[model samples]
Target: MAESPPLPPLAVDIDGTLTDDRRRLDHRVPSLLRKWADAAPVVVATGKALPYPVALCEFLGIPTTVVAENGGAAYVERTDELRFVGDRRAAEAVAEEYAAAGHSLGWGEVDLPNRWRETELAVSREQPLEPLEGIAARHGLEVVDTGFAYHVKSPDVDKAKGLTAVADALGIEVESFAAIGDSANDVGMLERARISYAVANADEAAREAADHVTDGTYGDGFIEAAERIRAGVD
Candidate 1:
């Protein structure tokens, strides 16, 4: 005679979790996510710049709530709230030091990744990490590698903080949400969510941090996790 638990809302990663290995949007994903949005809130969290995730929510027909730039910015649609982690002068200094040390920003002179980024900086993954970490540390910043790129940000800021902001804005606790991810930047979110899923192709840290590891990869993995969450199955 025990009552069933409530279905949790979702906070999801965009790139490797929603896109295929080619990083292309899986045509099946938007519609599936749109369906889920009808029943519960679905947060599209990503390490990309703010505009990307926000626009994604619009196109996907989900709430525009999102955590972008690897926790550097949090947007809550319900309250029209937009918050940034902190001043990025430190991250900017890191980039200056990195450039002086003969390291390329990796994406070329007019790097598109850094174009709209407000609170952090992104270096292409192709660049070596040896001195980049040291450079960031000197400026009191941390460099997080999200598989697609390396993000220079404040040590205290992360996707978990963004999730907390979203929870607060929605007047709910984060424990009432399910989260899925495929990279290191998502580790904090996965660990804090009520239920966490790491796709088959997820890195070691993410897999180790999740409650479940999906059998599929990319968009398919998200589908699997979503179905399991709805079924209330582990």
Candidate 2:
């Protein structure tokens, strides 16, 4: 039998990696995360804003840093320390630019009544576009095509940046990391890690980019990926 490689720190995506298509968090995934946390740091990196990951970490009983709003913001929950990586002034400038171009930008953190633990930004289509590429080209933001909606985001803010930030804070190198996800947004983090896994339900782009493709979906898929990482296979 081949010897297993050393286990690495885990960075996981939220929506599709740990939850189902409906966005409900599964209990088993958190349990498995905690199990792994005993040996390595497990960071939750998600496109969702701060509150979601904060709720998740609290529910999971895992004391880990969270990278929220893609890579725009990060937070260490234990200390309540927050880092706004993306320039707020820059974000505001971009927002103005988009608005001037007649594109609707849905600001994620703006309307929330309570102060957020992390920074988050979401750009969505308020009106239909005849050609989607036009908007993307105009703003230089990546256009993500969801089944029902279109999302535009800064090219700089991505899952990979978030993962790297968390790893750096924890003093873990990129080579000693594993990433798992199921979307185009997850592609960066997937590529950044030494080992990357895409779930059965992952998008084609994500699957193609991943080092390994898991047979399971959602939480079950993540569990399977964790098992494979523990067992050590490229």
Candidate 3:
């Protein structure tokens, strides 16, 4: 087997890396993550909102910090404390731009305004490119084409920034970290790590950017990556 990189702090993306297509966490992946957590701090950096990944961490019984809302927020699950990092002013500006271009913004919690835990915006599926461009230009937000949904978020609020914050808090250098992900949003976290992995089902862009591609999908892919890290095989 090829020699794997040294054990380092692990930062993983949630949606496609930790959860299966059904959005369920694999039974095996949690054990592997627990093993790594015992060795070093394991952080979950994702674009999901707080409650989503926080529940996952609780289930895994790992001491994990979460980056949610595409980097708009960070939270320490054990403490129930949160940090808001994204530039809201910039986000508002982008929303205005989208409005001017005749595109409406849809929130993940559009129906439950008071209960919405975080701010997430989706460009109107009916909107034309002009509005999309305006939205992107105004807030300096990136337009993520997810096919089913177009995610618009502040450029600074991303998985990479979340991982960086975790590293800083832990006093670990960037070279001593590994990241695994499977989406365009995961790109930031992947790029920040000393080692990066993409799952078999990863999108083309993600696969192209990854240093290594796992053979499996979802939680199985994470298990594969963890085994490689444990066996010292890259």
Q: Pick the candidate with the highest TM-score.
A: 1
lDDT (tens digit, per residue) of candidate 2 on 17-43: 788878788778867888777777878
* lDDT (10s digit) by residue, model 1, range 54-134: 999999888899999888899998899999985589988888889899998989778888999999999988898989999
| Candidate 2 lDDT for residue 230 | 93
Best by lDDT: 1
Stretch of 10 with least lDDT, candidate 1: 1-10
- Give lDDT: candidate 3, residue 75: 74
Estimated TM-score per prediction? 0.96, 0.80, 0.80
Tell how far residue 104 is off in model 1, in angstroms: 1.4
Select the stronger candidate by TM-score from 1 and 2. 1
lDDT of each: 0.90, 0.72, 0.71
Poorly placed runs, candidate 1 (over 4 Å): 1-6
Off by over 4 Å in 2: 1-6, 77-81, 87-120, 123-140, 146-150
Model 3, residue 157: displacement in angstroms?
Answer: 3.1
Query: Per TM-score, what order, best first?
Result: 1, 3, 2
A best-first ranking of the candidates according to their lDDT comes to 1, 2, 3
Instruction: Report the lDDT tens digits of candidate 3 across residue range 45-123.
Output: 7665677667778889898577776666677644556777755566567767666665556544353321343555555
Sum up the clashes in candidate 3. Answer: 2
